[model samples]
Target: MLKENKYCCEDHVDMAFDDFLVEKETFPCLEKSEDSKCSYCNKKAEYVLKLPS
Candidate 1:
């Protein structure tokens, strides 16, 4: 599944999943805003995943 999505094994799956959910909630603006940054890395859209269609 990950291979089909072009995700590397080292990528954190959980983080990617969370990013996907966020993206779905906010379609046009997939980047995490100042109010919605990752607690661990404080990065916006760093660990993004392509949701399954």
Candidate 2:
């Protein structure tokens, strides 16, 4: 499903997958300071967790 490709938000922004990986690799388990929005749609993301573990 979406998890396989590393998508988090309901909108499934392309950058979400890449951002998740970068965040995990660089700063695992770190909390996000701000909300994330979908790049393609420019809407508020609906990710279960703002920051991926």
Clashes of each: 0, 0
Candidate 2: Cα lDDT at 11: 50
Candidate 1: tens digits of C-alpha lDDT, residues 1-53: 22222121223446545554564653222232333334345444243234444
List pairs with backbone clashes in candidate 2.
none
Model 1 accuracy (lDDT, Cα)? 0.38
Name the candidate that leads on TM-score.
Answer: 1
Against the true structure, what is each candidate's TM-score? 0.31, 0.29
Lowest lDDT sum, 10 consecutive residues, model 2, at 1-10
lDDT of every model, 2 decimals: 0.38, 0.45
For model 1, state the Cα shift of residue 4 in Å: 12
